[model samples]
Target chain A: MAYELYYWDGIQGRGEFVRLALEEAGAEYIDVARQSGHAMGTGAMLELMKSKHEPHIPFAPPFLKDGDLIVSHVANILFYLGPKLGLAPPDEKLRYVANGLQLTITDLVAEVHDTHHPIATSLYYADQKDEAKARSAAFIKERIPKFLGYFEQVLQQNPGGPTHIVGDKLSHVDLSLFQVIEGLRYAFPKAMKTYMSNYPGLTALRDTVGKRPNIAAYLRSDRRLAFNEDGIFRHYPELDLAP
Target chain B: MAYELYYWDGIQGRGEFVRLALEEAGAEYIDVARQSGHAMGTGAMLELMKSKHEPHIPFAPPFLKDGDLIVSHVANILFYLGPKLGLAPPDEKLRYVANGLQLTITDLVAEVHDTHHPIATSLYYADQKDEAKARSAAFIKERIPKFLGYFEQVLQQNPGGPTHIVGDKLSHVDLSLFQVIEGLRYAFPKAMKTYMSNYPGLTALRDTVGKRPNIAAYLRSDRRLAFNEDGIFRHYPELDLAP
Candidate 1:
């Protein structure tokens, strides 16, 4: 049966991480909320989240339904889907390592979101622009490098080589890392200019993931959502910085 | 062999989540960095984090070494340690549900840290006081209530009754929730003034976990680190709210 993926309709946000993996594996799935004339539309997605009737409760969207099983959280969802979709190594040790890497990516994603919504998620960007400016400055100068640098080191030390994040083949983490690079680049082009030069290993992985046939096809399709101000990786000129 | 946990020596921080589960289960383990006159001192902790030679790479501390296996990330570490520690259910569905709840707690812990370091982790709280004030206000008024309310709902909906988060047994999630309550209480006593009365199920669960024979002993022992401003949950009186 095709997996049912429930997430917000408009922007990629956290759901994109799950989508990237599903697409890369050529897994049959439906983006429930984004679909039309279906029982699992945007309203249905919110209902599943808020309803206490579910066998499993989801605090938010971007949950997956595989047969009778349900899973949530980007890392948790990927953890479940990684092996099933053949995106993770079979060895237990390497599999957990891939999970750790995905969790780290989750951390980076949260940091990226904070750059724009420093004060409060409920508040508009205009209401918290000053705070965001300061936050974004620190993020662009310190955090981006810290996170990207750490990923570079992880790539450099990869036993399989500096290509995939874990082992020799493509893993969910590689796909997620590619998304991180894409989101970061779109949001902070000026800051990422130096990062591209400083972390050739990460860039190479990103380029490789981008060139994957399935991912390449997905990126070229209209199904791939654009990074926008409403989403996690917003491209405000003030948030971007140059070396 | 006993597990070797490497984290900061002084603060409970994220490591405490792993510590709580181990403590509650009466497991044999060493809080490596916290001990003295050993190979696994604070110095060794830093060395392992910086070293690229280990089988697994940890971007930060709060990593665990079990035999040759190394794991990082609080939720990821807990996922690996849960079943082994007898802190998770045997049933696969409930186990993953517990994991989802733990990952949600991870999200809450990150938010708690952001209250102090909203602008940047590198910047001191004093430097970001204004931003923190705004962030904490939003947190207390909105995020705290939303998260706590969700947990309350989770408890109320439990088929086994509101005694535990996942199944009828005491999982790592309940312990983590107890810690979250403790951390929030310590950091935002004034803000959590109504939390005791409002979230009766949550508060009740916290009381039960606190009274667990092993947990009660651990809390009284020197092994249990005190909640301090140095950690994720910080008590800046200015950040606390009345309602």
Candidate 2:
């Protein structure tokens, strides 16, 4: 049976991270909420999140239902998928490292989300323009460098070579990092232009992941959602650093 | 060999989540940064984070060194510790559920941290007080209820019972949740005071976790750092909701 993935249909958001892993591994899965004319639509996603019968309840969307088990939180879902999808290291020590990297990526994604919604997730960008401007400034100057630089160093020092983020293999983290670079570029093209040159290894990995047969196919396919103002990595002329 | 935990000497911050598991299990471990008269001190913590030789690099503190393995990120650290400490369930499926809950708690902690520093982590709280006040107001009204209420639903719906977060057993998620409630109360006594009665299940779990023999002893001991302005959960009279 194909694994069922639940997420909003409109944008990639956090769901795209999981989608990248599934695509990378060539794993059979159904993008439940995103499917066209499906019996279980967006409401099904909410039902699963609010489902009381399930042993685990997802606090939000982008959860995975793998036969008997349901997993939530992007990093946590990736943790379960990484091993099965051949995208994570078999060595226990290296697996933990992959997890740490994924969690940190989750952290970066949250900060990126905050740039668009600095004051409150409940509030609109138009309502919090000044706050988003201040947030985007710091995020571009400080957080982006700190996070991307750490990954750059990790890639530089990788004993197995910088082919992947964990050991010598293409782990889930590599896919997630690919997504991070993609999202950041889409959201803050001008701001990232100043910093991208410093992260050659990351840029290289992003390029490689994008060209992977499965990922390349998916990118060209209609399944891949375009980045927009409604998504986590949003572009606003004002939020983007001035040219 | 004792498992070595590296974190700052002061403030519970994120480290306390991992520390809680160690204490609850009465596990043999050394608080590396807290040990006095040692050459390592806090410098060792920074050294590890900056270490070029290690395969895994922690972006910040609260990392664990277990023999040859190194793990970082609070939830990631707990994911490693939970099973070893017997705080998590023996079942594999249940373990992932526990991890999902733990990651959600991590999300809440980030919001709590941002309440005091909405603009930038590089800037002081005073530098961003106006932004913080706006952030905190929304957080108290929205985030606290949303996170706490979701956890309450988890507890109330637990198959094993309401006492624990996963499979009727005390997992690392439970200990982390206890810390969440404790830190929030210490940091937002006024805001929490109004919402406390609404989350009796969570408050009860916190109280129960505190009274656990090992935890009870740890709380009274100096090892458990007091909540302060420097930590993730900080209490400023102005930030807290007024009586």
Candidate 3:
């Protein structure tokens, strides 16, 4: 049976990470909430999160249901899929490295989310705009450099050139890095442009991952959702850094 | 060779999650930064983090260096250890469930951290105390119930009595829950006292895990570091809710 992915129907949030990997691998999976006429949408997703029978319910959306297994958390889902989809290194050491990189991406994603909602997730963006502004400034100035620099260092140390984040192979981490770069470019265009030139290896890696036939095709396909204000990576002009 | 756990030496912080699992399994590992006269103290740990490596390094601490594999992220490290140390369920589905639960714990931990550091991770608690007071109140009222209720529901659904979070065996998730309970009690004694009685299953699970010989021994040993202000869960009277 095809794997079933359960997440909010609209907006490419954390679920997109899983969707990208599945699309790249040409894995058979159904986007359950997106299916027409299905009761499964954001509501069903939330209900499952509060399910009394599932001892391992997720705290939020972007959960995957593969037969009997229900998995959540972007990195955790990727950890399982990395091996299953051949998107991970075959060696245990390399796999761990890939996972480590993915977790860092998770941190970057959290930072991105914090940019808009610094005070609380439940509070409105308007309620915390000032706090968000301050946090976003620090993120753009400090966090973006620190994170991108770490990725650049990783690429330089690869011994395999500036193509892959791990070794010579294209792993899940490469795809994630591509997504992060794309999201940052969309979300904080000015800030990313200011820092992009400093990280040539990361730029090359992102460009290479984008050019992959499967990824390239997926990007052009109708299945790929557009980024919007509702998504984690939002592009508000007021939040952008000064050029 | 033994595993080398690299994290801040002083507080339990995120590293304790990894430490508890290692100790429970009786795995040979060194708390690298905690060892005296060993160059791998906080300074060395900072240097390693700032190192320009090929595989992107971890953004923060609680990373493990196992031979050539440098694994970071508390949940990610446990994901690796669960299977390797025989603490995870043997079945693939069950393994996914355990991981899902661990990720849920991660969300809870993030909430607990936000109670004190609502503004930004880089900012001091004093700088954000006003916002933290409001944020912590919401967390004590909303997040605590939501997370505890979910965990209690998990235990009630476990099919395997109130003893474990997964199946009949003691998984890494159970250990994490034990830590969560301990941290919550430390951070919000009055608030927890008011609501914890509602989560009997979770309370029982915590009690049972606490009674485990290995965990009990580890808690008494110097190996279990004390919780403090520098850690994720801190007890500030101003942030606490009155019973």
Candidate 4:
């Protein structure tokens, strides 16, 4: 059976990370919540979540259903799918390293989300614009350098090669990194334009991943959602700082 | 070889989650940063982090070193250690479920940290007091209930029983959940006083875990650090709403 991906429709959000990997491997999967029909769509996704009988209930969306098993969390989903999709290193040890790297990306993504919703996720962005400005300023100045610098260092120091994040091949970490770079560029075009030159390895990897035959095709397809304010990586001009 | 755990000294932050598991299993390990030797201590931890030759550089503290392998991130470390320490499910399928639950706890822990430092980790609590207040209000009202409710439901619905989180036995996720409840009570005593009644399974699990011989001994020993302002859970009266 094809995998069922349950995430909120319209916005890419965290689901984009999973979608990127599936797209890269050309895996057979259904974007369940995106389907417009009875017994499908966002309502179906919520029904699974709110179901009392469901044993392994996910705390939130972006969960993947494979047969009777349900995997939640982007990194967890990627870890489970990586080996099956042939998007992970052959070495078992290196797979853990890939997972650790993906978890770091997860941390960075959470920080990025907080840049706009500094005060409260329940509150509108306008309600906490002042806090968002303060958070975004610090995020641009300190966090971006710290996180992106760490990734750059990892890429530069990888034994396999600078082209890949883990072993000497394309893995899910690279795809997620590619998506992160794309999101950051979209959200902070001004800042990234100045900062992109600092991380040459990351920049080259992002470019290489973008040019991949499947990824290139996916980018042109309607399945790849555009970055918007509703997504995790939102381009609020006021939050974008020139580094 | 004894496992080497590196985390910043002085408080029970993320490291506490790791510590709880080790303590429960009676695993022999060294708290690297807390040691006061010439070649050890926080300086040594920094040296390892700054070492360009180290292939698997951890992004932050709370990383575990065993032999030549290094595991980072609370959830990742627990996932790796769970099987070794016999703190995970015996069945392979249930292990994935255990990991998913642990990841959800990880998300909740990050949110709890942000209740005090909503703006930026670089900024002191005093600097972000106003934003923290706003964030904590929403956290107490919506997030706490949501996260705690999910866990409570999981425990209540567990096929094994309400005592354990994953299978029929104690797991790292249960230990982590115990620590979370303890931290929340310390950080928001007033709010938790009113909200504790809502999560019966969690509350009972916390009590059960605390009563365990090893955990009881660890709590009484100097190894378990007290919760304070320096830790993720801080008791700021202003931020603790009467929920």
Best by TM-score: 4
Candidate 3 at B58: error in angstroms?
3.4
Report the lDDT of model 1 for residue B93: 74
**lDDT for each residue of candidate 2 in A150-194, tens digit (9 for 90 to 100):** 999999888889877779979889999999999999999997888
Question: How much of the true A–B contact set does each candidate keep?
Answer: 0.68, 0.85, 0.66, 0.74
Q: Worst lDDT window (10 residues) for model 1 chain B?
A: B48-57
Q: TM per model? A: 0.98, 0.97, 0.95, 0.99
Fraction of native Cα-Cα interface contacts (under 8 Å, chains A and B) also present in model 2:
0.85
lDDT of candidate model 4 versus the reference:
0.92
What is each model's TM-score for chain A? 0.97, 0.96, 0.95, 0.99
The lDDT per prediction is: 0.89, 0.89, 0.84, 0.92
TM-score of chain B of each: 0.97, 0.97, 0.96, 0.98
Clashes in model 1: which pairs?
A: none
Residue pairs with colliding backbones in model 2 are A87-A171
Better of 1 and 2 by DockQ: 2
State candidate 1's DockQ.
0.74
lDDT of candidate 4 over A1-243, digit per residue (tens): 899999999898999999999999999999999998886899999999888888888999889999989899999999999999999999987888898999999999999999999878888999999999999999999999899999999898898989998899999999999999999999988889989899999999999999999999999999998999999999999999997
Off by over 4 Å in 2: A36-39, B37-39
Q: Global CA lDDT of candidate 2, please?
A: 0.89
lDDT of 1 by residue, A1-243 (tens): 999999988899999999999999898999999987757799988887777876567888778988767788999998888889999888888888898989989999999998889989998999998888888888888888888988999899887888888988999999999999999999999888877899999999989999999999999999998888888999999878774
Clashing pairs in 3: A154-B53, A154-B54
| Candidate 4 lDDT by residue in tens digits, B1-243 | 889999999999999999999999999999999999876899999998877998888899889999888889998999899999999999887888888999999899899999999988987889989888989999999998999999999998888899998799999999999999999999888888998898899999999999999999999999999998898888998998888
Q: What lDDT tens digits, residue by residue, belong to model 2 across residues B177-224?
A: 989998989899998899989988888898899899999999999888
Off by over 4 Å in 1: none
